[model samples]
Target: MGEEPREHRLATPEGDICWFEWGEPSDRPSLLLLHATGFHARLWDQVVAALPSGFHVVAPDQRGHGRSFRPASLADWTANAAALLPLVDRFAGRPLIGGGHSMGAYVLTRLAAERPGAFRSLLLIDPVIMDPALYAGGDAAPVPDPADHPIARRRDRWADAEEMRARFADRLPYSRWQPQVLADYCEHGLLPAPSGEGYELACPPALEASMYQNALRTDPYAWLGNLDAPVTLVRAPAGPREGGLDFSQSPTWTGLGAQIGAVRDELWSANSHFIPMEDPARVAALLAGIAANQG
Candidate 1:
């Protein structure tokens, strides 16, 4: 039988962070899962359901997304990491395995570095950390204003969940996702509009765009050596070449494994940046393996 998750909300410095928990509160070790920029805690539901019994799992909706309280402004990944510190503290006296996707992966990396003993191991799926060369001279190219970004301009309201699902069923990235995953996204990734007329994206477009704009404000490469636990980085296939930019591929820096203290890197050419939603079974297996090894 699949494990059922319990929903929760915790007070944090940033805001009230919402999360989901699986398994009993025993000494079975804990896994902390963080979702990507525009995703929620429930995004890991599939992975959590597939995990082995007798293990505790927690997944949080990051600030400014999902059911979590939204902050006025998110400075960078560091700020988000700091806000999530309390959740990490919950696993203080036990084995904690950390895993995340894209922006979530970046946050986990930062948190593990800042608190080396907080996690026993890490699984980073297509983390968005950029190459050091891109940060040479401390120069990051300017990002377009959030209001002007394409993501910010996404259609917010829909007649209902079915309408939203139908609209995205044939969309680029959403279209590629597994059917159940897509259903989950449509179901939990939206909320009834404040006006009660329709449903709108749980993660506001403007907030998501702002996050993308500040994606490079903090660099994780500098602290890679501080991590003492084993780490696995799963990267997606290379994106197609555009004029000097490739938006369809993994954003992780090359040679990241070698630079980190103890790391193993794997590439999933068939998956895109959304590895968790694309293949939760594979992700669950990876997390289960890491947890089992710690026994």
Candidate 2:
């Protein structure tokens, strides 16, 4: 199956591990794409197409979301190590270049810390991290669990793509996107259910919100010195100020690039947190260059 998708299952403590892979099998250096918390691997579709066919791309549906089964807590990421680590050897013998968004990026760093030389270069796009207090440390103020936050579980039924698109376009949080792009997001965002149909979020809001807080247990910064892989950090420049709104003040994630200078000697600033989907051509170009170095 040259350039065809291949999937495999691995028995893991979290449940069965499921991963989606594609691109030419003979592609020189391997590139693995990992998505953020509560996201499916398909999120990288646009970015993957612009790459050289000689490059093999493997996108894993990280544990607890997408086709992969979920465990009771976010800590299951560590348990799936068996399934994810061997992938480096089973697919590409050499340290493969890895890129991930948000928690997926965090996972890559954890792997690098635990298993040096597993990846050659690391690309982290708008990762959601900070001192564990945001989720784990003593100073971290406790926010009510999503099991209690209604906005966290705002259930909805979409009659069709237009309805979903229009609804998302109407919302302010995503108001940053172009209308057509927003529509495309809504279209790809929903999954079908039995009969009348229920929409499934590419990310469960509660899970998305919880992982950051829960991530306090793992600190990639403290362990970055151990990893042999070269790292690159990319982020957006501003906060609510750009949106002309006072809401949420400076979105705390805006300055991640400035602070992560040690692990990532360089940072690429973008216009928003949704960088992969927004200006993927640039990301693809960046990854293409990365592939060249490893090749």
Candidate 3:
């Protein structure tokens, strides 16, 4: 956590996924951290900094986000689990500590269910896994094209990270983030524009929109029962309204913890969906406790 991590990239069927490693390999269980949608691996910098020493931490920018290869579309959410299999497998044959936020948490859930022994425990922060009923309807409403989605209109160009930070600093949801966290997000969230202009979002707006459009397409409940590792779910407050485009509202199902084999559910009444960004120290404390449990 003290020093910058060594960056690595792995090629998958979809494309290459970029990952970062901090600390040297040791006998202690390795820690794997995954970021939420539209976020890069570096967003966890603060959390990692607060973690106790001796952990070999690994964080990845899932496909279609950050420095990872981006396909034209990210409509198939399930494909991400498969894409990250190799990265997760690298920590196999030993106990590994896993922590993820939002969609990252959902992906970890899928992988944990598939290979229960690979994970020693899980810290899920406001996962996007909604009520099981939502996934049951085979005839769901058709999703609009990514270009037609509201997120597609997001400002694509930025003069720099500072400018991006200045714009979002006073905005809702983001305004709640720790100043350093927001700085990290802006610093690592942009890439030089392909047009050789200023800069563009690392995760294209259309691709981000595609992810939301097909959010409920994958059902992870079927695999939840197979998990043998203990899970700690940290839920944010339910939306003030049912839900429209409110990013601050929690999307996690209230019953998610009960569906799993061994789990503890927590309600973070004061926080929004972006728990890690809001309180990295709290997240690090929770993760440190999980890591301490390693035998």
As for candidate 1, its clashing pairs are none
Residue-by-residue lDDT tens digits, candidate 3, 70-176: 88788767777888899988777867888989999998888887776899899999998888998875226576699987888999899899999999999988999
Q: Estimate each model's TM-score.
A: 0.93, 0.77, 0.95
The total of clashing pairs for model 2 equals 1
Give RMSD to native, each candidate. 2.2, 4.5, 1.6
Clashes of 3: 0
Model 1 agreement with the true structure over 4-96: per-residue lDDT tens digits: 678898998657988888887666568899988877888888887677777788888899888989876554668888888888886677778
Per-residue C-alpha lDDT of model 2 across residues 58-92, encoded as one tens digit per residue: 88776666667665555434544444665555654
Prediction 3 global C-alpha lDDT: 0.86
List the candidate 1 regions with Cα displacement exceeding 4 Å.
137-144, 240-247
Candidate 1 residue 185 Cα shift, in angstroms, is 0.9
Looking at candidate 1, the ten consecutive residues that score lowest on lDDT are 239-248
Q: Return the top candidate by lDDT.
A: 3
For every model shown, the clashing-pair count is 0, 1, 0
Error of 1 at 145 (Å): 2.9
